[model samples]
Target: MATASTIFSDCSSSTTARLVPLSRIRNGILQFRQSVSVGWKPKNPSLNFISTHGRSSSSIVTVAMATEPSATVIDGKSVAKKIRDEIRSEISRMKDATGIVPGLAVILVGDRKDSATYVRNKKRACEAVGITSYEVHLPENSTEEEVLNSISGFNDDPSVHGILVQLPLPPHMNEETILNEVSIKKDVDGFHPLNIGRLAMRGREPLFVPCTPKGCIELLHRYGIEIKGKRAVVIGRSNIVGMPAALLLQREDATITIVHSRTKHPEEITSQADIIISAVGQPNMVRGSWIKPGAVIIDVGINPIEDAQSPRGYRLVGDVCYEEACKVASAITPVPGGVGPMTIAMLLSNTLVSAKRAHNFE
Candidate 1:
């Protein structure tokens, strides 16, 4: 009886044998015997005998390793860094050629800490990319007309290429009114109803895609992940992330299924997906068993959970259970370091794209 290690070592030493190591040889033999046991001939002998030890196979296995690649950690931080650098170069070139600097105007109302933080980050990203940042801060009791007027000013300003109204406006102010007032061309956040509607419809191109969802799709593209003809499940139906995500996936020719709070047996449906984008705010809503083997997971949730051990007394969490999902999933995005940075990057990208289109830089 050839021990498994001995067989693998011997196979590794062979040149002409096209040695199939025991790890794969066991699977191949089992598949062959199973076919024979069912009164069927193994129709794919070449596939069965081929050694799965090539560079591509090794690269994939290396990425999928439990402790080595850390369960296919999607490095959104690094990806965002690259994108920012590209944007910086583009801005420098645009300035040299056309002598115009793209400008982004952000309107922040009220004192919501989260919204403030997001606005600050957006400004910092603009500064890094050589884009001018115009920020308008209003009190919590600011009138709806005041917010709308700010948007109106940015709309007429030829230098301003992008306008983003920080979300969660005051209770008295109308959110839709403020967002709709932004000119479609300057609506970098893509919250305007017209952009959202265009994004949802087929055969139409949206002037801008919402930042977070666009970031997720950019991640998939950067990684060379296949999406066409694949089954993708987007958990959540919010207009911001989930709905736009599903629309984008559909645009890529993926068969998309949108799951919401009312959805029953969500896991049963999710288990069939080749790709899962969970944006539901519930922490750990998705488990290991809910994911298909070799499935790609994009976790868009950023719920804050209480933790006494942390300095902030709260920590960010995603909808999927990171620990368990790592075991079953082929690739996954971590909570804080993953989708968060990409959102800002995509916003900058959309701003630059808007500026180029406005100036006909292309």
Candidate 2:
């Protein structure tokens, strides 16, 4: 019978450390509980994941030891604040110089709580940056033609420089048709087929990039992460975040591979990536073992899971397991505070850009 140390020695050596499931070492031998202090900053010189278990339920127990986690936390919330300030300053200067202020129009249908909250937030963000926001809220039973009419109205309004159609529209509505109605120049959400097509081309540029994916790349750039010549993996293929993220990464000259539900041996593929952007809406799907040591991780998923301890009966989590990835990756983004804020900030950015182009403002 091999000891737990002997069994896992082959998995990692004394010089190298890797996280493994404690239950896998010996089926009936050990039971351990791991806990880390909430809001514990990772600036300490040592990798710290505290274990507090008085008694072992199994015959033998082994702990996963690791060196100091040096991963830089990609602070999206702070970066977003900086971006908003910059946008605010630019808007003031533009307004002063040309007496022109950027304006964003949003057409929202249905009454989904999440969608309503998102629309409200966008309106608030627009107001914060001195951008005028116009909204049309329709009942859930509204027809596609009605939504299209609103978009058409915005398209012709010179005062409205950016147009966004809140997503997850009623199932009966034709998303493609509705998205296409917004003039390409004012399509700030960047979901139009023409915008996506332009983004995919080498020599062409879309008037606006999707907010969430654009924010992911922006976070990387602000952090001084080099994307050129890197091996990148996008862990989803949805048109919104994953696909656009891959295209954006490609535009930055990084070699790209997409892993979807059908991909075999995801861990093996992910381990080789220098940069990984996960947008698969699965809670804690990517573990420590799936990460490459020193790789940069941009987690775009915001999945809610039931949590009895919470007042809301649920809590938000990202696709990448934050605790596990923090130990292995060189840098990572936290959910809620990570890609979430950036999305709205980028939306504001797109609106400002559209306003600048529309007014021929420098």
lDDT of 2: 0.77
Per residue, candidate 2 scores C-alpha lDDT tens digits across 237-290 of 777888899999999999999987667667778878999998876556666667
Candidate 1: residue pairs that collide: none
Which residue runs of candidate 1 sit more than 4 Å off their true CA positions? Answer: 1-70
Clash pairs, candidate 2, are 29-58, 29-59, 47-68
The residue ranges of model 2 lying beyond 4 angstroms of the native Cα positions read 1-66
RMSD (Å) of each candidate, 1 decimal: 14.4, 10.8
Candidate 2, residue 321: CA error in Å? 0.8
Q: Report the lDDT of model 1 for residue 55.
A: 21
lDDT of 1 by residue, 222-303 (tens): 8788999999999877778888999999999999999776676677778899999987655555766577777889988765
How good is model 1 by TM-score?
A: 0.81
lDDT of 2 at 47: 32
